[model samples]
Target: MSDVAIVAAGATRFDERIPRRAEELVAEALLEAFDGVKGLSLNEIDTLVTSYFIDARQVAEEWIIQDYIGHIPRAAFRVENGGGSGASAFYTAYSLIKGGLSDVVLVAGWEKMSLYRTLMANELIARGLDVDFDFDVGAIYTACYAMMAVRRMHVYGEREEDFARIAVKNRNNALKNPKGQWKRRITVEDVLESRLIAYPLKVLDCSLISDGAAVLILSSVERAKEITDDPVIVEGIGIGTDTMRLGDRAEITNFPACRVAARRAYRMAGIDDPVRDLDCAEIYDSFDTVELQTYEDLGFVKKGKGVEFIEETEIGGRLPVNMSGGLEGMGHPIGASPIAEIAEIFWQLRGESCNQVDGAERGLVHSHGGAGTAVVVSVLGR
Candidate 1:
């Protein structure tokens, strides 16, 4: 086993239309990511990993991708873990390289959510949950988060505007990202007044259903230096799971999965105090309360203090968060969302992001699937 690093990272514009098929979108990201590798070529890649949740077309992800991308000679695999599938695929590539299974791996995550109607697409996403308990009762993902939001507000006496602040900050940050989906500058009042989807969750609170893809090229540290001088080392990778059904969980406000995952990530990264040690973070803001809950689960602040972190968590504040505008404004393409989070951090480390965190060295990316049932945390550094 040897050290592994992300030598290249890239993504397509997160819009409703790119005129490219889902496979083509992934190919485009692979092309852009390969460009970042100085001397690396397609021949150097030893494995290919891809993730897609809404591609109703049952394409053999790795096999078809190989024929399309010119990396057919290497080993290949497809990984799925609901919305966390992207990060999970990356983890798979990491395991292969770190365990001496393969040296260079091309990992990609993609989705074509815009192809289906809103109701049908959401129903497909709901299929990821346990069918017996959650689906039978008509519990969509947003509805579960709504329960969490309601419980959180009751526990802390927090206002709906507090959740609105999450939407506002992320949307404001997205204004700087040319590839972001939601770029409009909005206010707390705007969020509060928006049409409600579930109680306490407005249209602004949910992430966009997008058509996008992202790719990252990873290699052993020994091979990384030969490819690029500026490699983003994968310092710590932590992934965990909670009860598949929301009703089975004991607490709604705190994500036990995130609590366990973040601890492992911080420990592996040698972080003593995340609030002071980390330069920035990209938590899974699929909804406003999820991001707020992450603030507590990640130990950035004490429980119930997430609302207060909102004021100081912006671009120039203490430990700037969601520099990519997060899922709320960045667009949630299911499998592609976490990969976008990774791409944002890669840019921040390279000083290339539109919303770049000033002097960011050590950064964190957190994402979960189906209302905290599946979670992953990764710490990256230059």
Candidate 2:
């Protein structure tokens, strides 16, 4: 297979209110991405892969977006994997380039969630769970993650404060990110004292529900060099899924799908020690506990010792994680989350991150969907 590289990346500022339609958000991101890649034109793009979840306005939304972005007559499609939709769409673009099917591919993800009420949005998100086993039992998305946190605390002696620390770290990291939604520096005490959304998970611990979009321009390795001097190569890609029902999984604390996906990505990237080899990571931390658990699930730390990895992931530590503030501090637009994660890594590799990791070479992006049911892991390098 041919190598794939990301030539340009862009994102709109994440916020609770963005007076733009979904297609407009994507178009805006695409415009910024185009500006980054000098001489690249929309007509040169061979394929357009869009990610969006439950847009009530239209079916086959990618087609609409393609026309709105003035990329008509190009091949286009949509990919949805719950919250992992962005990474899934990105992986599709990577495959298109790697398989020699397309030269230049545009991947965009967006969610105009501010159009719905909070409860309505929750209900829409809850639809992703197993209807018979989870939704029917009155399980919301947060409750599923909360159950995993409860089990981790019980089995591994993880404390609620440990999760709170993750919140504090990400929120502090957000202060440096211009595009992040929550820029206020927070403390563990702040997180612990916040209202409880679910047992063991406070309001501060949950990711922000916001409106945003992210875009990435990918091409064949040769095409990438022609497009730009600094190209973030898609060194490796892996995706997997686990049991849909939360109770069906044998292990609640660890996501088997994430482990499987990470192993595949690491093997493909020739990474022996993720903690040592990866310069930084942008993980899908929709919940603080999820970030802590991802450290172990993605092999950044040993199982049951994820809480200990927190200090090591700090700004000056060996491997800084979520320098973009993750989904928690950045914003969670479901389908756009992983795309933003990839964009953050792309910038980090190019020495353009707002919270730059000095001498960064390789970065890992891990995105989770449907409460750990689906996972996509990618390793990008300069």
Candidate 3:
């Protein structure tokens, strides 16, 4: 048995359009991943795990990237669990090293979503839903989450202003991130005034459609020290899944799968209380409201207390979250987004984050997939 650690991280800017193809974007990220790595070469990575959605853009995309990177004959595969694909791929790579099946692995994820117009791109994303019910009824991804938001209001009396506040916080954090997408500082009033995409989810409430890629190289603890003196250990990883259709769910106010996943990861990481144990977190925020709901789901606060905890998530507060600007501000590029989350935590633990939380030693990442159908929670430590 072996302990796994992230030896390096890399990413491309999240933007409306990059003009370059997916393979080129992937190459650019891979090159950046090796920038500061010492005494290690590309050939040292034994296996590759890739993740991405939007099959319409490129089918079996990993093969093209593998060939382009000269790893065509090596061990490699692709992972897709909606938006959680990147974290799931990282989980797989971690398992390979922990199980002694591989010494070093590369987890790469990307999305070339800006190729189509926003409407078409969103329509493509809606295909991830239950085609028999939600998709057939024309439920866009935003609507899927909006229904949850409306239900949370009905059950917990949460206000639309609560959701807007998250948007303001995340977009503002993007100001310091050169690779983040939406760097504009906004007000809660601005989010409320934006055109409504659903009943309560406005245009600004939704994550942007962007294209980007990210890479993380994972190695056994011994191998990690060879590459970097300071390695961020993979402390814990947990995943959970639920039924695809929302109507079939027993409760819509909060995602039970997320709680289950969080519990598993916490138990493994010896995190009795997340707020007390972790320094920072990069939660999956495909939509601004999702970020708030995730607080209770991850046990950061009790149910309905997410609104109160918003202020506490600020830079100087208890457990600052989404210091990388999250999906809302960084732009959710499907496969690449979750990898970006871990990359941010990797930086935070290494004291390299643009929005550094001083003295950060341990961090957590929660990756939510397809309207909360699945969740992946991982704990990382320096």
Candidate 4:
């Protein structure tokens, strides 16, 4: 099988109310993508895979992006799997390259969420919930996660203070990242004292509803050598899903899909233990509890040991996770956030990250959708 490598990657600054068209945001990220790669160009790309969630707002925006980005005539398509859309597009390109159907592929993810009011935008996001039940009950992502947080508290003795630490860590990390959205230095007290969205989950514990774009170029290993001297290899990719309704699952304490996906990716990458094998990670942090739960599902820690992660596994810790601030502080643009995670890992593996982890060589990126219904876990190495 042919190996795939990421030759270029970039992301627009993640923020709310970005004053630019969706295609224009994509164009901005593409500039950073092709900046250092001396010989690459849009014309050389054989395919384009775009990702976005709010398709109902503007039908077939991918075609518009294709035309605006100068890939109108070549093969181009859109991918939507809620928040996992970006990595879904990525794996599409990865398969195309691995299968020899395409030599060079461009994957871009963008979302213009700022176009709608926060309430309407949330309603759009909540569309991913089981409309017949969860939506009717008015259970948004925060509420779904909050219920899980409460269960985690009863079962594992986790506190709101424990989850609040994730917010403190990720937002603090954002201060070092220029492309990250939040720059305010906050504390656990700040997280707890912030406006309460759902019980145990305050405004500070939730990810932002931001507008952004991220781009990456993928190619065969042989072709990767031509693109750049420093190529970050896509070592393994795995995806899994569970029932959309949280009530349908056997348990709600953890995402079964994440564990399944991570196991598959880890097996493919020959990873015996993620904490020992990975130098850093950028997992989904749409909520602070999600990050802690992912730490267990991804095999970084055991079931009740999540707080140990919060206590010890940050930068300069055993395994630095979310050095780019993750969705919590970096901003979650849904479709583009996973690609932004990949961009951060791409830079870290290449020793080019703004907040570089010392001697980093391998990393993991997790893309999550719905109420832990869909997950994509990928392992990256230099």
Candidate 5:
């Protein structure tokens, strides 16, 4: 298998409106990336992989992009894995290159969610869950996170303030990021006072429903080095799936799929200590408590001890998680989110993050598809 590396990455300005449809947003991102490639063109891209969810108006597939965006089509397809679809799409592209089926692959993740009513979009998102068992029992995504947060508090003595602090810190980080959706800083009081969507989960605790798209150009390492000087190598990739129905899982405190996927990535990367080796991280933070739980599941801390990592001031506080402002402030455009996570890490490693991590050389990114049912982990190094 050949090494896969990201040579160029681009995204449309993450906003509620980009004055364009989903295909146009995708073309913008791809064109931005294509401009940076030294010897690559839309015609050179042999494989095209994209992710899209809730685009009810038209078919959201790679061929649709090829014809509408006027790209020279070679081979293409769409990947659907709920919210984590972006990362899963990257994995698919990597597999294509690894198997020697394609020399250059363009991966794009997009969603134009603001086009629909909030309630209608909510209903569409709710469909990602098991319809008969989970959705039928009023198990909306936020509601599942609320139940997990409640259990986490009961078992680990976590405070609602801890979740609020996560929101406060990520939002503060977003202020430095021009591309982030929620750039204004907010206090813990602001988060606490926000309307409660679920029992302990407030509107502030949840990720924003925004429209955005991100694109990454991945090629074999040889082809990548030919295109760009600073290529982020895909050192390791891992994916895992758990029980789709939240009630079927044994515990809600931590995601087993995340642990399994992270373990696989660490093993492949030969990483014994993620906290010491990894410079920064971007994890799915659809909810504040999800970030906290991720610290434990990803081996930043012991099981049920993730809350302490957030409270205590330590040198390596669980891998500097979510320098991107995460999904909460970074804007979660469903399918576009996971690719955006990788894009932020790419900036950090290159010392180009407007809100850059100091001297970051290696980073990890994790994305969850639906609730905690599907997950993908990837480690990238300079």
Candidate 6:
């Protein structure tokens, strides 16, 4: 077996409207990635993996992107696992390189979500749930997360204002991220006053329906040295899944899939204590409550202490989390989100992130799909 390294990463600004097709967005990201790594050519890539959730326009999106990007003759395919598609695609590319099946691989993810109305996009996202049971019962995506938030509050005595603080913290961090969708600093009062989509989650608490793309170039350890001097090594990767129906889970307060995945990743990375071992993190924050629960599930804090952990995850805290504003402020483009999370970690490891964490050497990236039914956790270090 061989080691894999991420040599270059790129992403377009996350926004409501990018004014371009998904393939075009991918091409832009690939060009930027190429610019970062000197002497790297598209022809040198032995495999291409793309990730996207909805079929906004066409099928076989990977083939379409390969044609648009002029990377023909290279093996290419698509991976779709709801919101975790991007990280799943990245894991596939890492496996190829680690197994010695390919020396160089290109991983990209994009979503042109602005093409549809908010209601229509919500409908599309709801398809990830059980069609006959959940979706047909008039369950919107927000409601799924809302139920979890309600349960967490009921069991742990957490208040809505605690969740609001998560939104404010991430939005404040977004002010430093040039590519963040919402750069304006917000307050806990602002989140509380916002329109309530569900019982506990306000409009400001939800992630934006963004349009964006991200790309990463991975290579074998031997080839990485030849391509770039600073390569972020893929230390560990783990994927886990729970029931598709949120009701099937024994506990709604925490996502078991995230706990399973994070434990595996931490063990593989030789991390006995996530809070002390990890320098920073980029976890999926589709909803502010989700981020709070993830802190407990990821072992960053003790269970039922997620609310208190908020201050500890701030910019200058013990272990900064979501320095890229997470999905709340960075914008969640479904397929592109997980890839973008890894890109943020890569930049942090290289001291190039817009909101760099001081002396960050090891970082974690987490992504979830289908109401926590699936999770992918990865550890990266310089």
Winning model by lDDT: 6
Candidate 6 per-residue lDDT, tens place, 1-382, comes to: 9889999999999999999888889988888888879667888999999999989667888888999999898899999999899999999999999888899999999998998999999999999989999989899879999999998888999999999999998988988898999978789999999999999999999999999999999999889988998999999899999999877789999989999999888888999999889999998999999899999999988899998889988989998999999999999898899999999999999999999999999999999998999999999998
Off by over 4 Å in 6: none
Q: Compared with the true structure, what per-residue lDDT tens digits does model 5 show for residues 77-101?
A: 8899999999999999999999999
TM-scores, all models, native as reference: 0.98, 0.98, 0.98, 0.99, 0.96, 0.99
lDDT of 2: 0.90
Q: Per-residue lDDT tens digits of candidate 3, residues 243-357?
A: 8898889988888989989988998899998999999999988888899999999998999889999998888889999998998888888889999999999999999999999
Error of 4 at 231 (Å): 0.6
Off by over 4 Å in 2: none
Error of 4 at 247 (Å): 0.6
Error of 6 at 257 (Å): 0.5
| Runs with alpha carbons beyond 4 Å of true place in candidate 5 | 311-318
lDDT of 4: 0.91
Of 2 and 6, the candidate ranking higher by lDDT: 6
Which residue pairs show backbone clashes in model 1?
Answer: none
What TM-score would candidate 4 get against the native?
Answer: 0.99
What lDDT score belongs to each candidate, Candidate 1 first?
0.87, 0.90, 0.91, 0.91, 0.85, 0.92
lDDT (Cα, tens digit) per residue for candidate 2, span 269-372? 99999988899999899898988998998988789999888998898998999999988888988778899999999999999999999999999999989989
Comparing 2 with 3 on lDDT, the higher-scoring candidate is 3
For candidate 2, list the clashing residue pairs, or say none. Answer: none
